[model samples]
Target: MITIGELGEKIVATWLEPQNYQILHHRWHCRWGEIDLIALDNHNSELVFMEVKTRKPQNWDQNGLEALNINKQKRIYTTAQIFLSKNPLWQNYNCRFDLILLTYIIRKNNSNQGLIKILNSNQIMYENYIFTIKNHLKNVL
Candidate 1:
């Protein structure tokens, strides 16, 4: 079975494909770390580095911005530089770094809350489950 990270990357790629992005790489590992998704916007001639996170109610990474920490940002930036070096012709194009957060809310009493995005990480109280976006605290040890 694929892990959550792997599945998250796939979902993100699928989400971006119809949006007109050419996915160049996913889970590109480097000395720094893994870049979730690297895409090329043909129409805009820009490169986009995206970080994706998915979570169940109890495991949600809130705001999803936590997925891109300072170190992760640096790694993505450095990796983009390396990629740029290999294709100098595209160096002049714009570069963007973004993030996507996926989370689900659940309740035993009510099953219709699945479409709502949980706003608070620690304060929500559901009948059976609560969704919370958490800060990214992955230690690169």
Candidate 2:
């Protein structure tokens, strides 16, 4: 099963596609840490290193951007540097760090109203759940 964080990344990628961003990598990891998404803006020839934070609607005390502290920023920058060093072709592109915050509302349907049954096992049908993105923030750092 796909985790909520992974699902959020997909939603963010989908949101970025129409805006001319081509995803180069997702979950790129190095000794420093992992970059949530690495994308190139075809329209402006800029490299984007993104940090994605996914939170359920009721779990947030602050905006996701605020969660990226100085230490996290340092780690992300170091990782980006490593990425640029390993990929010389992209070294010339202007790079920027961005933060994407996704807030999802997950609804469990116990009633049959507006619920789609996907499977039937022992005469028990699985109700469809909905995941909705409530907010997205970009270029926070």
Candidate 3:
């Protein structure tokens, strides 16, 4: 059986398809890190690099979209750069970053719902898991 995380992505990708987006890559991993999905909108002539997070509950660090941190973003960006370098076709394409946060839910009746939440954030370019992105406790590091 496919894992719950994979299942969640399948559902999300399906939803993104009819919207006129072409899926270019999935689970693209390298020595630096992994990028969950890469899609392109041929009509708009834009590229979308996506990161996905899967969880079982509302248990994030806080009530904010800080699940993916600075360190992670840096790795993702580097991976994207490398992908383009290898695939010159996307070299001049305008690109944007996206985040897909999916929550895997379970029910009492042995059934569950795959709740997929999509967030589009280009501000976060790195990962800071232990602290707030706008500010930091200097001594903590």
Candidate 4:
């Protein structure tokens, strides 16, 4: 079963693909940590390391922003360095760190709610609470 976090990443990837970002890796892991998405921006020829935060509308930590503290930032930075080292081909590309925030909300009234059911079909979901892209902060780090 795909976890909610993984599903959120997939949704972000799906949205990014149509906008000229080619997903190079998903859930890229290393000793330090993992990168939710590694994408290449065709428009600018840049390498992007994206961190996704999915949460219900009502929660502490400012919808997961607080979770990316200095410690977490260090881990992600180190992981990105490792990735670039292993893939020398992208070493010359300008790199950036991005943040994607997803909020769980119901479609009927567009209110924050808990996720109920999800389907793996191309349609994304059947209708309860869905993760919506709340923000796309580029070059966050």
Question: Of the candidates shown, which would achieve the greatest lDDT relative to the real structure?
Answer: 4
Write one digit per residue (lDDT tens) for candidate 4, span 1-141: 877788778878887886899999999999899999999999999999999998888879777788899999999999999999999999999999999887765467633344323333222332355666777889988
TM-score of each: 0.64, 0.77, 0.68, 0.83
Task: Give per-residue CA lDDT, model 1, range 88-117, as digits (tens).
Answer: 876887888766666545456765342432
What tens-digit string does per-residue lDDT give for candidate 2 at 17-110? 7679999999898999989999998898889999877776666545465679999999999999999999999999989888876665545655
Better of 2 and 3 by lDDT: 2
Enumerate residue pairs that collide in model 3. Answer: 69-126, 69-127, 69-128, 70-126, 70-127, 70-128, 71-127
**Least lDDT summed over 10 consecutive residues: which range in candidate 2?**
118-127
Residue runs of model 2 more than 4 Å from their true location after superposition: 109-138
RMSD, one per candidate, in order: 8.0, 7.7, 9.9, 5.6
Candidate 3: tens digits of C-alpha lDDT, residues 1-141: 866556545655655676688998888878877777788966787888876555555555532237667887788889989888888999999887876655544434322234333323211111111111122111110
Compared with the true structure, model 4 gives a TM-score of: 0.83
C-alpha-based local distance difference test score of model 4: 0.82
lDDT of each: 0.62, 0.72, 0.59, 0.82
Model 3: CA > 4 A from native: 62-64, 108-141
- lDDT for 43 in candidate 1 is 76
Candidate 1 — which pairs collide? 61-133, 61-134, 62-133, 62-134
> In terms of TM-score, which candidate is strongest?
4
* Deviation of model 3 at 27, angstroms: 0.6
